[model samples]
Target: MSKPLSPSSSYDLHPSVAYVQSILANLEARTGRTLEAWVALARAEGPSDGKARVVWLKAQGLGASQAGLVAQRAAAGPGHAFDDTPAGYLAAAPGYVEAQYGGKKAALHPLFERIVELARSLGPEVKICPCETIVPFYRNHVFAEVKPFASRLDLGLALGDPAAVADLSGRLKDTGGFRKKDRITHKLELTGVADLDLALAWLRRAYGRDLKA
Candidate 1:
């Protein structure tokens, strides 16, 4: 069987100010991934980068729970909505990986799992790509056989782990689902993102639309 991906993780500093800043700094230092650009939606100050950093610092200071609040606060102008579309636009996201071997995917598998679990628990389904690399590894794996959309985007794996189908009950939508449902597969699945993190982050971002319920 194909080996399983690594573990998952969450932020203790997520819901706090001081801690989150420190954590974000660490995230940036290790992977150079941060919400640095989000800080510019509101009124501009003298130093543009500093303004972005301060807005982020404030958001972190308020804590992870307050992140959405921070998003709202920063989006002060007309019809501002935190511009979440960037998350989907990986081709353009900062630190976004065009291929699998990116460090963020390798280092943060555990964190990705947590995000996936949260999204799956909230709503929508998860599908792990049943790629040539993965299918040979799993024996009892079940997939909802739909046509392939992307040349590289088909296949389903058990959500939490390749072996834990019953426990996690999740699938990654490789085909982007049929017309009624929209599937936004994470390209990192094939990339070198730690398998677990790639799966988790993909689930969170792909299924993010259904999270509200």
Candidate 2:
């Protein structure tokens, strides 16, 4: 059998893992209840549906983010949801990135790495969270995401309203909407390392905006 996860286990040193740990570490202080306490409370009396559970938790005094986290853990139950532990999530993070770059999209891995490196270089607070299809970079909130394709990678930026900025006009393709709070208002396609400079420029602007937000 696999070893049990320990809170003190040596976790992946990625900034994203650290970022999540920071949130877990601060849960009690922020919500006046420990994660286990919140999970127990949620499972015992919270609504069965996830969205409703978040709303219910918020009514019980938890903030939006905290409520969501608690609801997610409760919904995933004990062994799932990355084993409902930081160590489990950290241990699984590398596999998540590997899966994203596997097979025909393998060639885009290097480009993705360059983008992540440049994004990380923007500041110490940048956190890289990898999902199944995209790797999101966060600063207070999600400022950017790198989505890979067989031939190119799309760098999505949360630049508020691209049209309102004259220099950004006609420079980026809209990814649907540019609402002020949209996590991804625009996308820049990158086919090679040559695109890194332009990506970094826009990334820096997005990162700065997130800092102020």
> Best-fitting candidate, measured by lDDT?
2
* Residues forming the 10-long window of minimal summed lDDT in candidate 2: 1-10
What TM-score quantifies how close candidate 1 is to the native fold? Answer: 0.18
Q: What's each prediction's TM-score?
A: 0.18, 0.64
Q: What is the lDDT of candidate 1?
A: 0.32
> Tens digits of per-residue lDDT for model 1 on 99-173?
231344344333333333433342323332212112111112222111122223232332333222232324343
Model 2 segments more than 4 A misplaced: 1-83, 167-171
Model 1, backbone clash pairs (residues 3+ apart or across chains), number: 27
Question: Model 2 — TM-score against the truth?
Answer: 0.64
Error of 1 at 115 (Å): 18
For each candidate, what is the lDDT?
0.32, 0.75
Candidate 2: the clashing residue pairs are none
1-213 per-residue lDDT for model 2 (tens digits): 123223223123344445556667899997788999998999899889989999999999988877877888888744332333556666676666778889998888777777777876787788776665677888888889988888999899888776665453455787765754567988898898778788888999989989653
Worst 10 residues of 1 by lDDT: 130-139
